[model samples]
Target: MTSVGIDFGTTNSVVAHFAAGSPAVLSSDEPPADWAGLGFDRVLPTVFGRGLDDRPIFGWQAKQRPGSLAAVKRLLRAEERAEVDGIEYSVEEIATLIFGHLKRSGAAQGVGFDQAVVTIPANSRGIARYRTKLAAGMAGVQVQALINEPTAAAMSYSMRSATEETLMVVDWGGGTLDVTILRNVEGVFMEQASKGIQKLGGLDFDSALARLVLDTVSDSDRWTQDERTGFRLDVERAKIQLSELEEVSVPLPGGQYRRITRPMYEQVIQSQVHRVREPIEQCLKDLGGSASDIDALVLVGGTCKTPLIRRFVADAVGLSPAPGIDPMTAVAEGAAVASAILGGDLDDRDFFVSTEHALGTKVLNPNVGLVFSELIPRNHKLPARATETFTPVRDFQDQLQVEVVEGDPEKPLDDDDNVVLKEWTITLPEPRAFGEISIDLTYSYDVDGILHVHGEDSLGNVVLDEAVSYGASVDKRELTRIAQRVSRTLDEDRIAGPPGPSASSLSAADRQLVNDVQAKILPFIDDAEATQLRSAVTRLEGGDASAAAELQAATRQYSYLL
Candidate 1:
């Protein structure tokens, strides 16, 4: 069976497959003449557009549209459908569009991979990874394996380089920032430590650039969506130009233009530039070493291409980067190499899976009330399973809420913001606690990188055991509808049309805010309005505070009292 590793990135998605003796990225698939009008390349954009079509329009085909959207990867756990133009679409729907684009591109090269491996950020744990797998299933390719992005990159590096050395993989892409430290022992790549900041990426850089340009304008506070979007596009383009040129003049809306030199550009995003070093520093700290301890620094992702970042990481790591592969395709190439290994094509050696986040439950502390307790710590090798026993504070506790979150277990678990995986409640027949009954939470992470959670009584009876739930996955009809939707995209692939647009990002902390605010307000709005509110909340929660605030005010002012 043909197999490939898919880096379904925040900004762009790439596919690489095992071929004659090695893995290769399908980088030469250019859009057809008609598709060329949509403005695309080998790297499929992770975006969807607003339209009247039954299926979502995506990538370049989404450009110049009114309701064009991007960043569905970050919104995977979000249950609300985004309304663009007059249509509404779920997070899975938008993701399916992106995956479908990848399928079409692969098929264009006469390679429709039946078995595939999809890679996600090391921080993309629990439900986020499950949603990724679901998206792949929607695209008609059964996932053979799921690998962390940096691990796959390391696999790629080990494949090309025979020399054994300690190397660092800094994968700063459009939506997530992940760092992995690994060693090539003989031929096997062993990850020593890993860390990530899911909310940080290229989109943040774009937004910061937007803020810099907007600051030069008088009505920055009152800027409309159209105005913000236009500035975003221009500033984003100029930022890309600054990477190649010493300086770039960006045209802001309202006939304003400013010259942004590399130094000036760096200054605008200086705070964020410093933030990039955080995960790297933290990873090194976890390894009990300094930059000098790192033998070679491997840079991957488009944002890592910026001269300022490359120079800073090189200086910070105290080592010059190894020059061989393009940073942009490094992860895709690495994932491709991993796919080959998993497919048993390359028997050089093997790699291991590491959990990106701590897996645990929220339990009542004797003195502190409810707090998080971890069963599996971050970076633990998989397939990992762990169990912890606990008893209720009350003599007779009728119910137990088993909320398993993927985050810093050291942190106090206050709300859903601390969760990335699953949350389920177990109801007991009668009041029982302490000696009356013993509760055990069992977490088993499988080979597919999926987690199976189980709660049991001391008698060994299963209380709750299942995969983590998706906001929309609970509905059987919804799952069927999504499957049908994904299948249709394959059919649309044959039509040679339906390219549209989209954007990227996500984090754990915001989950709390969404659960509290959106749920209460949902009953007040219609389907169309609810979709818009969700997109607005997703944008606002994703650091688009401006758009979210404006929409909130507009809703309050124009409401017909329900």
Candidate 2:
């Protein structure tokens, strides 16, 4: 049986299989052409609906229904429950709906696999990843491993190259932007450091452009509710056009309009770009290296296809970006390659997989409410094990709680933030003094990075035994039924489709701002080649303003245009 690799993205998802001789992206029941033009053979919309019959409908079909939620990924971490037509769902339930669709699609393809690997964001913690696995399980797929997105991309790159070199993988996906530095030493690609920002990605750029449009055209008194909504939609379209063309004109109400220039788009999204760069810089600094040290800068993810993103990455890494590879497909392709390797079909000589961080628990003081001992340190190799001892807070205390946490303590709530008291169990023991040690907390991370917490008191008594669970869980069958029913009802109430190209999508004022940006950036785009223009557009449309500013600064190589 072939092992499957799945990239469950926020905006889209794809499944690939390694069979026969090489990896192939699978085709869905949906036509291949219907898939997102950015390239995957099976690009399914990450949207699912609850129909009146309570059966979940997924992909483009689900989106066709009225009020069907398109961006469920945004609600994954939301404390508030998501509801459509009186049916409520948690993130895990939403994931189950999507996974259920994938399962059906795989069955239709007649490819059965026992083990599968799923890709996740670099910054996701053990609990979030575990929840993903659970969701997959509910869909009837057994997850064999959880791989980081950038690592998967690197694996794919290594499969294509024979020479060993250090490379930086900049993955600008729809909902997240991740940067990873890895060294391919003698064919083994080892990650030195990885970092990312949660809020930066393509969607932000769309919103930014929309806001710019609204600001330009609508007056506080004249703007109707419908117009405001329409402008937002138009702004998204304009952003798409700006990615492909030099300038895009959006029509507005009141006989007024605005033209969004490529340069102006870049200015509009400069802050977003800069946000993406901060992590890259931090990764480099952590690795004790500089941009010049990298042999190549690899860009991956749908958002990276934008010209601006490519240019920003190339300029940041001090080298021209690689050609011929589709950034969006790279991660899935790499994941497929890794699946092949794990199945023992591909030569292991080309690449090696190792855990880049250690998993551990901290010993906390009940009385002081402070962490006193460190059990695990970052960057420890995988399949790792570590243990620590803790003393009782009071004399003759009968019970103790073993709190398992993640990440480094020194940084304090950083991107690498640690999860405190994730899982704990009460232990009963004989009376002991405050200074007398009572329990030993041993934290172990399996090959797949799932954390298992084991505790034993001074008497060698096992206290808490279950593996730590993260995130909420829902009844799959019930959720699917509710989603289906809600979806059907929503379709009945639909009078018109989602907001179209109107002043609501982008206002006249926003168009003027885009024009202003064009006046500043058009000369640069005009002088730059097609490749340069594409990179600039990617950076601009990817919606990281800070990254855009960096691209502007780094592209000073074309300073003559300025």
Candidate 3:
């Protein structure tokens, strides 16, 4: 089986693989002509929008579709089920769609991959990580390992860097800011400390620019959804342009423009720049080493390309980031490096992986009467096992149920709707009075970060060990079904070649329809009413006349939110 590495990002996703003893990033050979504005060849945006068939359109095809779900990686942690075309798709299912896209894109380049090493943020909690695993399975691929984003990047750095050095990676990406301190010791990437702000990243910078653009416009609330999308796209493009040039102009809807100089852009985002400095300071503290201890500074993520960010990082870390690293694709490339290690294609040193979350079980507290008992702490090296024995309350316990959770055992999930990561109830073959029996709860966190638990009756010699079933998660049988279904779907895609223009793509006639509908609906609907309008536009692309009906009904529904 060919080994690949997938970097499923918050904004853009990519895949890399080891080919003929060398690692390389993969892109599409010829994207379908119909997917004109979508699928940008090298990077696939983590976006999905409702299509003409009502199934969600993905990748670049979803880009022009108003209300397309972008920044979905960040949103996955907050959501469980999404209403997609009136059919609810679990976050894992949504992620699977993107993964399938990557897999197919790689397949197009003649690589038949059955295994991969996927990377996630270092600070990803249990549920999010679980969903990612399910997603890979859903895409019909076996995940060799789920590595940390920075850790994977460190692997890539180790290959190119000739000397052993204490390195710091400031991963300022679209969804989060992760600061990792590690070392390249004799070709092994050793992690020292990992710290991150999950919610802070390029989106904030875009929002800042968006706010400035909105300020420039009069009666911004009356702007159409297309206008809003146009403005956001322009801001993002100009932000990239400002990196290379001193100034760039953002074209407004009505032939107007918002001129942005690099200095002005820096001024607007200075607060964010200052905010990023916190993690670096904290990373140093965690490492118990000064900035001088960092022999090399490496920048990853597209946001790091900005001059302001580069300058801030230099000042914060007291060293310039080493050149020759391509910030945009380094994480994915590093993932390829890690994938090589797992596939046994390359073995320079042993790679030690760790858990991203703490694993523990809930029980009665001695003082509080009811509390959570932690079995293991976060970042504990994988293939680790923790065993502890506890006594039941009564003479012979008929059965015992223990709620195993991630994070601090003392702390429950912030949301009441969210449940503990794992919970199990083991029944004794014979009814034993509570106090007489001892329950040995053993937790084995495997190399993949999967938690396995077993309860053994010390005297009875009966043990029940099973995989923890979390909410909306599939069992092994269901995983097989999903894998089969995904395999069939991907095979069809491979046979069909590239898809043509989708319902999500906006045509010239569709623009006319949007204009006509917006005029009729805006008087009653004060907001852009993005979803309904986009869906209506999708319907029109599918040859539905009187799309105005969709706009009118949607306008009424959206007006309440205003």
Give the winner by TM-score: 1
How far is 369's C-alpha from truth in model 3 (Å)? Answer: 7.8
List per-candidate RMSD values in Å. Answer: 14.0, 21.0, 16.5
Provide TM-scores for the models. 0.80, 0.75, 0.77
Quick one: ranking by lDDT, best first? 1, 3, 2
**Lowest summed lDDT window (length 10), candidate 2:** 492-501
Backbone clashes in model 2: 66
Error of 3 at 335 (Å): 1.5
lDDT of 1 by residue, 467-526 (tens): 665752345346446655566655753221121112233234344335534644455445
Q: Ten-residue segment with the worst summed lDDT in candidate 3? A: 493-502
How much is 265 displaced in model 2, in angstroms? 2.0
lDDT scores in order:
0.71, 0.64, 0.70
TM-score of candidate 2 on Cα atoms, chains taken together: 0.75
lDDT of 3 by residue, 103-144 (tens): 777877798675689888876755566667767756755677
TM-score attained by model 3: 0.77
